[model samples]
Target: MPYDFGTWDRNCNAEQSQPLTGTLTGTIPSWLRGSLVCNGPGLMKYGDHEFKHVFDGSAMLQKFTISETGMTYTSKFIKSFAYTTNTEHQQIVVSEFGTRGCSVTKGFLSKLGSKFQFDKMFSDNPPVTLARFGGAYYATTEAPFLHRIDLDTLETGEKVNLHKLLNLNSQCPHPVTLADGATVNVHSAVGPLGPRYEVVKFPPTCPAGADSVFAKPVKLASCETRWKLNPCHMHTFGLTEHYALLPEQPLTVDVTAMVANTIKDKPLIEGMEWLKDKQVKYRILSLETGKELKLKVKSESFFYMHIANCYEEADHLVFDVTTFETPSLLHQFKLENLRTKGSALAGEVDSGCIRRYVVPLNESVKAAPEENLVKLPGAQATAHRQKDGTIFLTSQKLSDVAYENPVVNPAMERKPYNFFYGISGDMTSNKASVGKVNVRTAEVTRWDAPDDVYAASIAFAPRPGATAEDDGVLLVHCVHAERRRVSLWLLSAADLSDIASASFTLATDAPRALHAVYMP
Candidate 1:
């Protein structure tokens, strides 16, 4: 069955406050108590105009509260200034990462005048990640600010600016929480001279100070490069217990081009230039000492959105990531092309695979051949060699499965773990399903939804008092394309079997989610 794009497009409005009353299949777990919150772009169109990129839509927050007796569903749009202002104007006045704003009037003067409206550049649409920090719920994007959401009511709160609070300009949507409750994140800023990245730590509670309404950030590590451009458009970085790995790809950001594009009223995503000749640079920083080591690796020019997990094993640092060969995956998200071309041909979209890269920290006893020992060019480090004198960065292709929105067992994060779960499907197929992969064995188990159903990302809800790593239920958000309904499926993590399901009816179809979180 083909996907109902028209139905999806119509269902992009703000969800009502009423709870979805529906039937429950099987039985609700008596121990289950908490909320599963998912964030994504829900409003694709504004009055007469539609967003050019799928990511340009305003954010929507969907909350599913699981009680002992049953589950209730509700959703609301995050009331960011951008969302409210656009709603009041009945048009997309704010400039998004991929969506440029139309000038209020014609000519170069109007365009230049619009560029001065820096307020329009702030897209508080926190559609990428749903995070809990400092005892508050937050919807975060790649932007510098964090939009607070009330956990009880799912209402949007004030936008917390890290730039104002910590003097950090950009932040990763995904933040790693330590065992002691301290949260760590990476923030990057680009300037005319070059770019710099900082690793910041936040306590579990807000600190004392005028700028400390939220937790105060303590900078642990800082790195600066004089390359005259921001290398890699990084969304997330890898974290281990003792080290943080920053994989700097070749997706160079042209600061001049970005400014020119803004003045020209062009989309900022185009300002990113892919430097095909540059190798991926991994900046390994010691969490304790703040010392940094640069390791250069050779690979085909590729793009990665998220790092699954990273850990230190003796003298080796191992990490797994979802990789893409090019930015063509973005082209596949154009709604106009999807409507005209149809999604059946999307199988040809090869976005790459999940691979693990192992980097050796120890020095190699064997020396490089005289012919191979070339001068270190530019700022690039010579590829580290293994003990056997081979190029040290060894990569293993774990699986051919093309999937994203990956999550591992929460308890096993920053440590060695095996299983990983995510939404799985071919690029062109609308029939998505939940899949689990055993990283150690490359064994994959999947649960496919009905032909008319599409599964969003899966969130692992760890069972209370569970012993084993996989002892939990996988919570999946599913959407019925033609019927225009949505449901949450609770599957057994041991086998991916449907343990229970709760279906609900909505006034409009829910947009596909980018990520979700289970709070228990």
Candidate 2:
């Protein structure tokens, strides 16, 4: 099913490519869009300049220096992202590899020659990896291929064919999604071989007897032109060395009922006509072996969710798990002792903690109307893993849980105005705050920020040679904590009480962002 932008909210004025609904056209506002992109820091060494992109929505370039303190990188931004000390060189650097475009209108609008293009031009769905080397780095702007560049050399290195790398031919949709929900229909053409069978010639075949046969390319008898679009996806896999673990929720289809309900002149139901009432399958995969393993987790479904974050403490894998209707969950899976050959895609081979969290689903909290009680369309959240094992998650918790006009019946207005006002009758802005969870003890804590403060990014910095108690340092981004401005917060790592704060008035205001990359 294709995305329907108008169905979720009529008030949305931004023309979006899909119906993921949260911001305009379900896209993040330009300011807020930048907020979410501030997740991971990149180190690009250019000759004498050690350019580190310290994220706070707008990328801030810093000079990296090494001293007895460990490693220190200074940013021009008000609050600095401090690193203890290291042996890395220090220099000034800038990235031509800046944001392809603001995620707001750039993704949804279909305009040629425009500075922004749909996120589809590049891989936007699954989390992408960005690496930096001396005066250079590697990134993939398109599917089916990966590119590396020597920032100093200005030479494009060898292209790694993702299809060959992952062993999936044209059958896969380039393992990317349109930042907006639009599709470029590519007609099948004869290849040098014959019918142009999608081939995997790069990354060699999977290990013998691996779960390679599980996720057979979904062969549809016909294109999904008529099926009602299901916004929730089962899984969105991020890449790791020698593996691309994809999680998914199965599509429900019923051949008999599909045919009976067909009012169109023609209905195309071929191989998978039997999929009607089947529950969606949610699991993880081992790209090397094509192994599909089910995750013993449940929660609310999401079309757009930040799936993974790097946590050295979590054995490198910390994931946000939630079902469409279930409470939000944070799960940490360590690579230690965990095997991928079995039916249990995930297990407690080691140990981690799960916490119960909620993103308000009421009319007041949702950017759209139909979402009354924690069921908003296209609500996105990100959980950042600090240097320690603790995880900090950003979400909007509504001050009010009930709405005067509940959409229990279809006959009610599909879209509602003044609906938010009614739901927020007694709501407080500061009520929507960021929460912290300790994976070891499963202890939970909340920090109430100003009403306008939307917690966007949370990072950690430990003092040199400091113990757990001494590692009380943090860097937080409040996209709008300071009146549509981007503000940085320095806080106690042990307790999220603010230590210091600095503000930067955006030349242009933005929505609270979801990710950031910190550099010391």
Say which candidate scores most in TM-score: 1
Q: How far is candidate 1 from the true structure (C-alpha RMSD, Å)?
A: 4.7
List residue ranges in candidate 2 displaced over 4 A: 1-245, 250-304, 307-432, 467-472, 481-484
Q: Provide the lowest-lDDT 10-residue window in model 1.
A: 372-381
Count of steric clashes across candidates, in order: 1, 58
- Runs off by more than 4 Å, candidate 1: 1-11, 103-114, 190-193, 210-215, 225-227, 365-392, 428-430
CA lDDT, every prediction? 0.73, 0.28
Pairs of residues at least 3 apart in sequence or in different chains that clash in candidate 1: 346-428
Question: What would the per-residue lDDT of candidate 2 be over residues 1-520, giving only the tens digit for each residue?
Answer: 1111111111111111121112111211111111112322322232343322112122222222222222222222111111101112232211121222211124323322222221222222111322332222333222343345332222345444434334422222222211222111111113343322221211122335543311122221111111333212222333333223233333322334433323221211111132334333223333345443322222232322233221111122233322222211111111111122121322221112221222221113213322222332332333333333223334333221211111111111111111111111112333234444332333434556555554545544445555443253445555452333445555555665766554444322333323333334
- The local distance difference test score of model 1 is 0.73
TM-score per model over all chains: 0.91, 0.37
RMSD in Å for all candidates: 4.7, 21.0
Candidate 1 positional error at 91, Å: 0.4
Summarize candidate 1's per-residue lDDT along 1-520 as a digit string, tens digits. 5554443343367685887755689887777788888888888777886787778888888888888778888888998877887888778888887788655556887757767564555566788877767767688987787888886788988788766565566788998878777788888865455578888788777777634435556777767742456556778888887788888878766778887878777776778787777667778787888868654434445788888888876666677888877766666666666666665536546646777776666644465533222232221223345443445353566667655788888988878788888776454455676778887876788888767677876799888999898999999987777545778889898899888888887777667777888987
